[model samples]
Target: MKTLYTLGLALVLTPLPGLVQAQASAEPEIASYSIDTTLKISTDRKTRGVSDTHGEPGLELTVEAAHESGLIAQLQLGSVSRVNYPEGNNLNAMLALGWRGGNPEGWHYGLGAAREWFPGARVDEAPAGFDASFTPTGWVNTRFHTSYLVAELGWSYLTARYLYVVSRDFRGANTATVCGNYLLVKLPSGDLGPALDCYGSAMQHSRGTQLLDLDLSYPLNGQTKLVAHLGWQRVRNFRGLDTMDYRLGLEHQRWGLVWGAELAGASVRNRDLFIAIDTDGTMRQMEKPKLILTVAKKF
Candidate 1:
């Protein structure tokens, strides 16, 4: 994990020493860069019906660079803490490069490639009587060494994205594809407030999953906003594996700094794997209904 972080940081910080020089003198250079850091504190750290952080807080950092020619690159690094794996913090990193074009206000399209890495994740053996030996450990690792290609098209307030699994196998699947659609609308600042966003995704694979989300945001004042989210996820080919999640948050932003507090919860179903807690305060699965605090800065 340390090595991966070092390498990613190096790539992010290194300058394109000769590329710009090779370009034609008539062309102008338009470069932009930004750094964002976030601190997240949560009651439970679960994703996709699986607990990865065992109800703990996490931190993340992202850096992005882009050029007017539509080329962009991004690097992100984060820490994962699990109650069962207290010996070390699981580290994850993602590196992506892409190109985007078209008008932001009218129509736009983008194509990108991304590589996600998990260095400290391991496959755990199932407990006695379980048919499957390879179960995902609650260690913040999907154990997925994957590379994917993404394509997106957007017009006005609607956008669609498709992701193709370019790697031979991601996790345990040999091939997988996912498509997502989003709708966003700006509303008047009345009782219900200002914005509405809806998103849905369908994944194709042996154990496919479908996800849907609705988010609404209301402006409380000039610098504060109230946000609410409702989400549903269902796993195909498996009955009784549906889950519902919701979140309510209040955020304030000023001078490129943002802070928020949220209450979130999820319902567990029979198909979800149950994590057990031992007498020594060690937790195997995550618990639901989390309180979260977030602080972020963009530069």
Candidate 2:
């Protein structure tokens, strides 16, 4: 009986090392977490040419985590020198779930849902008895929120994405659907090793907004690159409101640190109407020919 018991114990111990190795090998290897910070200095802080900071600099810090299962969560904190609110800062957080597979040389698709929260971010309200023919008094403080369901499909140097807004603030100006497509072409080495990126987007809401853009990047050296961008935008609802914008910039990356400087400007038709009204019924024109500097670190 003693000899039989010893044989059973030996049988169990012999496979334990192999079992541990198999378990370890089965763990997913792609899970990661990262934190990054960016300091942005611009003459005007805005989204798509709508002024948010009223020509003030902005700083942002972001922390993100991702799992091998394609779940991601991120928190972004931003501060501006000026905002409609007295606090001069805001918080944005997002949680997303997505799956990405396949190599760049093959067709790939990613579908995800992201819930974005802008805690305490103010919404711009139309003036009392505002008319659609005329612009609102200006953007004022109100509660604004949004969510998105997004999908991307890509193969090689071309990609396309569709973004649908599931929720938004009471303001009717927000876009409900956005579709974007981009193509990248790498120029031959003799052509200064420049790369060209062409993009187009259509945003749908009460009306359609379309944008076409071209970006070029040329390597200046091992660590520095020169970039230029030009874009044209049109709004279907607002006639004579088409605009052209451009940017010239240079970026350098070294030791996981990135820095950039850009000069950007936009020419807008009926620019005054594009300005947002403040809670105090103030309308400030968008600043043009702005200089921006940015520094970022990744970990």
Candidate 3:
């Protein structure tokens, strides 16, 4: 009787191998993460409907990582135009950190901040013997580095984003001498065309510049979509430099590659404010309407 009792006790205390394995498999798994990369080549790199590539071709690479918990981080680097960022390294670098949540089929919201760095880029210094006292602090020699905060809201197929500049300048737009000055462009008719005041103030920093963007993407088919965008760039204290920009584009995905073509242009209060002068003294209107083409691959 005692031997029988001992055998029964052993059988009750030890779990079967199959049961143990089943219990282990039933436990929930930790959330997983993924990293993605994209490389792109485009006829022109435009920011807010203004050309950053001076109507030239550009290359860009981006890396992004996402977690199941709705956090994302991204880094992008691209080649820029010397005419657009005179005296600067022809490089455009941006780092963005943000969190996004909600169902893609429903509503979504996001908040982020980004910094744009243009290494060694600066505007021409104040004219010789110009009154230095009229300029704001660090205005004459500061590089073209800008930081901004962004907020986003969207539903299916439509989204709106607002970006507020927190930096001293908006891509070096608020230089001291350029304020209240006329941007003069010589016309082919041997005359100066329409001129407008810069409307910026020497004593003011461009810390409050803001951009509002509205975008729409409507699927035309399983692999192609119609994209449209409208945006306004408001330069605080320099309203004359404000612009309204628009884009109409189509994007298609096939064979693991994405192709895009867009018509982009901006209506500025004055075109001269968007004109870029190269080191060679040639000027290119950066906001003119143009067709931009792009191809990108993801990994």
TM-score of each: 0.55, 0.55, 0.81
lDDT of 3 by residue, 91-129 (tens): 999999998888767798889999999987766653312
Where does model 2 exceed 4 Å of error? 1-44, 80-97, 104-108, 123-141, 154-161, 170-222, 226-248, 265-269, 276-283, 287-289
Which candidate model has the greater lDDT, 2 or 3? 3
TM-score of 2: 0.55
Best by TM-score: 3
Q: Which ten residues in a row have the lowest lDDT in candidate 1?
A: 176-185
Error of 2 at 278 (Å): 6.6
Q: List the residue pairs that clash in candidate 2.
A: 123-142, 138-276, 138-277, 139-276, 139-277
The clash numbers for all candidates, in the given order, read 2, 5, 0
For model 3, the run of ten residues with the poorest summed lDDT: 1-10
Candidate 1 regions exceeding 4 Å error are 1-51, 83-88, 105-107, 124-142, 153-222, 225-248, 267-271, 274-287
lDDT of each: 0.52, 0.49, 0.76
Candidate 2 lDDT, tens digit per residue, 1-299?
A: 01111111112223564473322222233334434444444444544444446666666666665544455455655553334332334544456666665554667667776665556554344232212453332333334445666676766544555555555331133222110000011222233111111111222232334555555667789899887766666655443346777778898997777788888767887553345444554555553667777777765
In TM-score terms, candidate 3 sits at 0.81
